[model samples]
Target chain A: MSFEVEDRVAGATERLLGEGTPFTRLGVSEIANAAGIARSTFYVHFADKSDLLLRLAARAMDDLRDALDRWWARRRSGDDRALTECMLRVIDAYRAHATVLAAVGEVAGYDPAVATVWRARVDRYARRLRLELEEDRRRGVIGAGLDVEVAPFVVTWSIERTVAEHVRSSSPTEDRALARALSHFCRSTYA
Target chain B: MSFEVEDRVAGATERLLGEGTPFTRLGVSEIANAAGIARSTFYVHFADKSDLLLRLAARAMDDLRDALDRWWARRRSGDDRALTECMLRVIDAYRAHATVLAAVGEVAGYDPAVATVWRARVDRYARRLRLELEEDRRRGVIGAGLDVEVAPFVVTWSIERTVAEHVRSSSPTEDRALARALSHFCRSTYA
Candidate 1:
């Protein structure tokens, strides 16, 4: 019941975002109006706007992980286009919720809780990347010269910052170029 | 006359930061007290906390570019240790003003003007990296397969984020390791 209400609010927020409402300009009352819930119900479901954004951002991160998994599976199967395919999926995942993610970036500066949550999630992904690199080394795909220790931080944070910034600012026409850049970055660095 | 006051405030802020005061917790009066200036003088020289941080961050970025130039010059002279030497200097440069940089990251999330200034400067650096890549590719230092379009974003932002996070959170003992990782990352990827 709670998630249903949250989903309604999230869905409505996304629709409002689709119409081009800046996330910072959005309010609970507005979200409630769009979600068809009482303004007070927003409190029952969320502590505030940042709370709602945190939940949504978590969902988005989860989707990105799923998209990454598809890429990993394809790579293991020796698909040459694995990185490119994965990046396109990841870009779409971010594009689907660019506004919410931008809000997360905006709020995360001053909001300690939001920053902590985002950092923790990104750290987990970095660790996972490290594991993947270690496995690749064992499989003899990456050369011994690869510094698995630091390269994960390099690739993970670079992709996150570059892709997030690209999605937030660039025109949709440049998505393919950005995606190509991203896939090429990862392929040359690790593969 | 104005530059004198700004430098005083920046120096005092750095000292207070050295003494372990959180930048967000810092106030105008506190800064005045430390700088030996009137509270009203703070406003005369600066607009607000975020404004002051932007100026400080700009200075820091300038120092960083200077450090990178040293690396570039050293690399031009065929110094194999150019990147390692450069990262050590860059890390020291950040450590000198780590607190100010952290505040910039914090406030930049919500402050549109601050975000814009910071983004423009970073964008300029990314362009510089792109130019550098083109030069390297022309010189045959990097391979033909290098995607000059995207690799600049990869190296520049990746280096910035990884080094900043390390300087902010990690121990001094780990500095050498981090520097080594950064150097190896650039060397293997580019050289």
Candidate 2:
């Protein structure tokens, strides 16, 4: 699909999923209606609902990576405010794509393609975290006894879980509190 | 359904899921065939596949809770070895019922019944962790500045994500190592 077409489909998917419908039970006609395209036109861009989901899943990951990259670039100077802002921005991006993230997680084991994308994203994030930790260690911000491998896993998994909980919770304030607590924990645990 | 019939169907469901065959695609018929029961007999016990899943999800939670309870009881006096054993046992129980747990998680948002069961189980576990944390706080074993609510969520979600990663990993040794590292992280974080 062309970039414009893919962007349109992705926008429609975000709206549809944000409406909180069961994606598995959604039909082509529904997606077409949601996208403001003819049912026949839907087939021109995708094979079926699953195909659309696969595309959307890929898009979500790419969008997430882009967000992270932007955050990393914007925070290259490593000020505390920059770091906190970047982390919160990343969390917000995840929240915006929460439904798709949850679906991708659910199917990670059953779908090889999805699992590969998911694992690759996780590994990339882990590497980024490892680099950050190594920098901190070199600067004597963190204890020398920190195990490099385990620290990354802990940070990645902890951040992921914190975001997942925030997305699933009903209260926005709770999520804010959670993000603050997690940011503090991350700094304290590592530093 | 009679108690005996429910028990029989539950056993059959457990067996079919444990096998993890392509027959999963055929749904209830495959389960019926594996159980040596007729389709009508299957329906007599479960209203539908979701009903069967509800039973299985409940059973998985109960089994996990029982295992944890037994482990906790055995370690009521508290020792490092007992703590390690309890953590491993919990991870093992999660691995044993991963499929059902995954299914429950997938359907949770769409199905109120399934969501209720899942939330209840998670809440129960969280409550247990809270009690333990409270005891530790009273004993001055953990830091005074800890946020009580956030601590349990962190510990619970961390262990959960660790077990999930362990189940998805190809190497058993890596899984064990991750589990051990997670247990260690929990000890230090909580302490």
Candidate 3:
């Protein structure tokens, strides 16, 4: 699909969510009308609602991964500020598509297809986190007496689950506090 | 319901699950037939399949909580062996109702009623864990630089999620390794 068409769908989806319609309940005609496009164009661009949701999930996951990648590239050992900034960036990425994420969260719980796609993305992040922890352990600075195998998953999910919870209701101070708590635990455990 | 009736239903549910029927797909008549009870007897006890599921969840959660409570009663701070044994007991309780827990895991993902009950139980465990951590911190044995508010939730979920994953397919060696990995991480983080 063209960028312009994709943009239209994304905008329409958001409006639908804002109006209290669930993604699962959204009709293709409503989406097309909201996007000021023909119904036929909707079918031409996507096969079904499930496909659209998967695409939205992909878009959001990509955005989140990109934000984290930037943090990982510049991160330093024991640098609390770096990790906090990384979490803040993650919160921003998730908040950017809050509506889509909310819908995805609900469906991913029950739908095998959606759950599989979502879990695969989480695993990708965990894999990268494991690699980073492994590298940190080589320098003998962090992860003493801790299994690199297990600590990474715990730490990754700690921040991921915590950040996901905060996105639903957020404040700058609260986010900062959360990041601090997580950074303290992460650094202390690994260091 | 009488203990005999409950036992029969539980046995029938296990047999159904063992034969590969998803809990949500199970029929009231089928359950009644498998239990060797009249269909009227089933309705007299359960309002519906949903009610049956809720009861099954309650039974399993209670069993798991009792096992954990016993472990917590004997738990000593920084005792890796104690924690490992606690997890082993938890694994055993869950294994006892493996059929029901598997069903609950799937439904709890999407069913609000099931999810609410499951989360509330998890919250109970987290609250208790936080209290224990606060006590240990006061004793100056662990949790030197962590938030009582956040760390408990993370630790609870880390072990909870890890255990839930392991329950699907398990071995004594694998469970021991998992328990040890968790014990090591938990000890280092809080100690």
Candidate 4:
């Protein structure tokens, strides 16, 4: 029953944000109304809107992680085309969840809870990515002096910022071209 | 006389932000006291705190552009170490203005003027960087499939976000190593 209310609230939050409602203007009462619950129920499920945004952001991060995992697996198989394909999937996912991701990004700077959640997710992804790169370095697939320690930070930020901008703005380049360029750049830089 | 007032106000803003005063809590009176000016004088030089931050952010962007310009020249001259040196200089500037930049970034999400100013600055940088990459591609220095149209967006974002995080975080990576890695990544991926 609790999970059901949380789901409704999450759905309502996404709908409100999708309709261009800024978080500050989004009141608890409105959220509860949209979710067809009492305002008190919102408190039961979420401390505040920021708390709810964190939940949504966490969902987005999970989707992102799934995309990265696929890329890692294909990359481990030594398929030359893996990176390009991986990037395409990632971009599609970004498009799919652009609204929620955009809201999370806007709120992340000032909202402590959202910022904490966002940073934790990025750190988790970076740590996992670093481990993979270290393995590649050990196997001699990737070259030395690549700063495996720091390269993952650069890689993840680059990909995230680029895709976010693409989704938010009017993109000139097509999907395949972007994926190809990113894949080529990553492969050449690391390997 | 006017320039002096503006300078003092700018300095005061930086100090306040550096001391961890959130923009929401900063007021005209506090700024006047810090700058040793009357509240009326503060009005003459700027509209509000957000306007003051835009000026500061503009200053930071200029410093960043200067660093990138030097890097571009060295890269064109085929000076192998240019990127590392350029990135180090950029990182130093970021550190110097870390507090103000952080403030600008935080307020930018909700402040329309600041957001507009920040986006314009990024767009200017990206456009310049794109022209340089196109020139390289035309000369066959950079390969053709680089997605010159989209690569600059990625490159500028990568450098900006990476440096910003490095300045804002308790970084485990050494300065020289980080510079080397980023320089290597940019060189290998683009040139």
Candidate 5:
């Protein structure tokens, strides 16, 4: 029951953020009201707006990590269709939470705590890519001369920034094409 | 001259943003005072803070475009040193305007006008890369089947996002290595 209420609050926040309302404009009362809960109920689940945002971002991160795992698995299996599916799933997440993510991206600029947390998320993704790149390089699956450290950083940020920009646009590129192209670039660049 | 005052105002805004002061906290009177100008003078130039930011972003975009042009020239001439120099120049511009850019980036989330302008800048950069990629593909420079439309989008966002994140970092990666790695990735990806 607690988790359900928390999910409802999270969903309400995401819906609000997704509407192009500035994160700053989102009040706790509004969120609680939208979630059909008492204002006091919001405080029970989260300390503040930032805390709520952190929880929302954490959920998105988990979904994103799941998508990335699929990418790794499909790529390892050499299944293009599965790889593209994974990419689309990730892109869909970006599209679904475009406003929320954009708000978070904006806050990271001036908010040190947010910036640290955001960078840590990217670093976590990069760490996984680095491990794969190292293994690939050792196995002669990719060029030996590629900068192992930098390659993963670029790949992770490339997809990240690209998707972020895509979601922000009113007319985003077709998802399948973006997925195919992005996956192709990462594969060719690293593999 | 008016231009000199505008530059001072722009510099002050960048400094203020870089100091982690939210744009909402920056008053026009404070801006004018920081620029050593009368509040009236600020109005004589910029209509509002957004106008000042657009000017700042325009300047950064110009410098970025110039650096990209150098990249094209050096790559065509097969001058690795020149290529690295151009990349370093671009990186330096990103670092110098990091705060202004970050502030602009933040505003872009909820402000349709800012978001449109920012995307246009990225689109313009992507357009140039597209044309270049087409020519390169026609000349058998890169693989023929590479997605011409999508490749440049990825490349432009890759550089734009990478540099933006790089500038935001407290412990930024060494400029030279970042330059080399980024240039190498773009060159290899598109050339």
Candidate 6:
């Protein structure tokens, strides 16, 4: 697909997802109409709605990973504030594509390929956290008695679920407060 | 609607959901056919697919609450072993209705009513955990300085996200292991 076509589809996806409509039921013609493109043009870029959905979902996950990596790179050593900011930034990235994330999470059960992609993405994120924890353990900053492998899962799930709830919340202030509280909790417990 | 008709619709809902089709797109006629009833009969019980879905989602949430309550009641104090068992049971209950939970969580964005119901249900569960934590604190089993409200949200979301990832995993044993580790981690940190 040309960059222009991809941009149009991305725009249409953002509009449709933001509308919060029943996305699974969105007709091809409706999307084409919304994109101001011919029905055949839609097929040239994507095979079907499911294909388009997978592409959107993959993009969101990749974007999330990139955001996390960038956040990690900018963090200063032994700086709790920077770590918290990094975590919050990652949460913000997830919030940017909340609708698509929710939709992908929902449809994962029905599509093995999508489920595999979601699982792989989650594992990759968890691995990065695990590496951080391992480094902390090596420095004796984290308790040696703790199981390093399990710590990442615990921390990742805690952050993921908390951020998910925050994203789903209608009140922006409440979400921000929860994010701060969660980041504090994780830092205190782990640091 | 007659009791028998309601039962049939409920039964059909279960069957259709079990088949794992997109819950929002499951047609009234399909449900009616699955129930061996007239296509018009579904209308007698449900105003629309959303109505049926809401009811199913409610029932699933209620079942989860009951299971949690039962598990909590069966436990003797804050024994780590008992807590681990209870957590596993709760995870099992979630696994049984994983599809519905995922569907509801996904569609929550499109429907504020559903999102409200979900938030309330989560709050109720969190409140129960908070009460338990308070009791533990009073008994000197947990730290007094802990933020009781935030802890409940953390624990609830951790278990929920763990079970969700577990249900979606090809190797569910990882989830069980994580749950065990988390049960221990939570107990030790707060104890």
Q: Better model by TM-score, 1 or 5? A: 5
TM-score of each: 0.84, 0.81, 0.79, 0.89, 0.86, 0.78
What are the clashing pairs of model 6?
Answer: none
Candidate 6, fnat value?
0.31
- Tell me the TM-score of model 6: 0.78
| Predicted structure 6: clash tally | 0
lDDT tens per residue, model 5, B1-191: 45899989988887777677867568999889988999999999998777887887888778778877777767665566778788888888777767776767777765667778988887998898788878877887776546888888888989888887777663555777778778777666642
| lDDT measured at residue A58 in model 3 versus the true structure, 0 to 100 | 79
Candidate 5 per-residue lDDT over residues A22-98, each given as its tens digit: 78667889999999999998888888777788777876777777877778766665666677778988898777667
Tens digit per residue, CA lDDT, model 6, A84-125: 677777778888888888767655645666667776777888
Top-down TM-score ranking = 4, 5, 1, 2, 3, 6
Report, to 2 decimal places, the DockQ of model 5: 0.54
Q: Under CAPRI classification, how is model 3 graded? A: acceptable
lDDT of 2 by residue, A1-191 (tens): 56676567668776787777656545677877877778888888887665676777776677777777765565435455666577677777887778888667655544556667787888888799778767767877665445676667766766776577667764555655565455555545543
Clashing pairs in 3: A143-A190
* TM-score of chain B, candidates 1 onward in order: 0.84, 0.78, 0.86, 0.87, 0.83, 0.81
Candidate closest to the true structure, highest DockQ: 4
Clashing pairs in 2: none
Candidate 5 B-chain TM-score = 0.83
Q: Which stretches of candidate 1 lie over 4 Å from their true place?
A: A1-5, A11-41, A75-79, B1-8, B15-41, B75-79
Tens digit of per-residue lDDT, candidate 4, span A137-162: 89888877688888888788777777
What TM-score does the first chain of candidate 6 have? 0.83
For candidate 6 chain A, which ten residues in a row score worst on lDDT?
A182-191
Question: Where does model 3 exceed 4 Å of error?
Answer: A1-48, A166-173, B1-44, B169-172
lDDT, model 1: 0.75
